[model samples]
Target: MLLHLPEGGRVVHEEHAPITLPKGWFRVIRQREYVPGSVRIVAD
Candidate 1:
């Protein structure tokens, strides 16, 4: 997904600490895992 932070912001996840970001465009990528037949986002 594409994210745009005009005035900057913070990202928080349950398994990770809050990440501070500068004002800019960013790409959000999910962690992927490979299964027997396909690849998918890693589950926590």
Candidate 2:
């Protein structure tokens, strides 16, 4: 997915520190985790 921070902004989450984004376009990628048998997207 793609995210656009037209005027810049901040992304916040309880388990992570806030991310400051510049005014531009960004590609969104899901965090991945490795398990015993497979790989999966990390839950946020």
Candidate 3:
């Protein structure tokens, strides 16, 4: 996964993965992360 922090907001890129869901059977994959609030923003 690739993450980009632009001047306005944040961007994220993720690769597909396999996952199981309740009630039904399915597969899915995703990438994600959390950014700290201490980071400075250009607008806010």
lDDT by residue for model 1 (1-44), tens: 99999999998999899999999999988999999999999977
Q: Write the per-residue lDDT of candidate 2 for residues 1-44, one digit (tens) a residue.
A: 99988999999999899999889999999999999999999986
lDDT (Cα, tens digit) per residue for candidate 3, span 1-44: 34333333422435545433334323333644456855443431
Q: Tell me the lDDT of model 3 at 18.
A: 43
- lDDT of candidate 3? 0.38
RMSD of each: 1.6, 1.5, 14.9
Task: Give the poorly placed runs of model 3, Cα more than 4 Å off.
Answer: 1-26, 37-44
Give lDDT for model 2: 0.94
Off by over 4 Å in 2: none
**What TM-score, to 2 decimals, does candidate 2 have?**
0.71
Kindly indicate the candidate among 1 and 3 with the higher TM-score. 1
